[model samples]
Target: MANSPQSKKRARQAVRRNDVNKARRSRIRTYLRKVEEAIASGDKAVAQDALKNAQPELMRGVTKGVVHKNTAARKISRLAARVKALG
Candidate 1:
């Protein structure tokens, strides 16, 4: 379908970018899940630590264009609130 050389090159680039983005998204989800599990387990200290580790990953996702800035902010805010409530 990509008849032009430029289009073919773009398609190839897109495939590579897609793989990279997918991996990034998966990594972000894994980090978020760690925080969630920590919270669910009701271990405030572990949750706090997980949150600390996840905050930067989430922000990195935003900076890398995997997630929106406000989205990451909201997630961090809500998770922080939940972690605080555990106290």
Candidate 2:
């Protein structure tokens, strides 16, 4: 029900943004899942590497507005702790 031209344009923009954000979120999740799988496999080295890779992706998500800053920080902190404990 976007009667106004501006509203219609906004709706279109929203759809585009939704697609981009969805892809970004999915990519971030893939990175996190890699770390989790490595951790589950009990491979400390691989887990550490995956964690290192995922940390930046998560932070990038925060910067891109795809994720909340505190949420990203908490996730990274907890994952780091888990990686450290794998020793």
Candidate 3:
């Protein structure tokens, strides 16, 4: 439905951005799942390490606009608390 040339270009850009954002979101979820599995397995050391690795990935998601800043903060906070409680 993009009749204008500009609109066509915009549509193309949107598709590319959507694909990139989807990949980034999937990657972030994989990292979070790693942390969750580690936590569920009751291994504090592995959970701590997974959380450590996930922090940068989550922050990257925020910086790339795939995730909200406050949402990232809340997620990291809760995950850290859960990891800590595994003590």
Give me the candidate number with maximum lDDT.
Answer: 3
Q: Residue 31, candidate 1: how far off, in angstroms?
A: 0.6
Candidate 1 lDDT over 1-87, as tens digits, reads: 899999999999999999998998899899899999999999999999999999999999898898999999999999999999998
How high is the lDDT of residue 35 in model 2? 95
Total clashing pairs for each candidate = 0, 0, 0
TM-score, model 2 to reference:
0.98
Tens digit per residue, CA lDDT, model 3, 9-87:
9999999999999999999999999999999999999999999999999999999999999999999999999999999
Which residue runs of candidate 1 sit more than 4 Å off their true CA positions?
A: none
TM-score winner between 1 and 2, please give it.
2
CA lDDT for candidate 2: 0.96
Error of 3 at 31 (Å): 0.3
Query: Model 3, 34: alpha-carbon shift in Å?
Result: 0.3
Off by over 4 Å in 3: none
Put the candidates in lDDT order, highest first.
3, 2, 1
**lDDT against the true structure, each candidate:** 0.95, 0.96, 0.98
For 1-87, candidate 2 gives per-residue lDDT tens digits of 898999999999999999999999999999999999998999999999999999999999999999999999999999999999999
Clash-forming residue pairs, model 3 = none
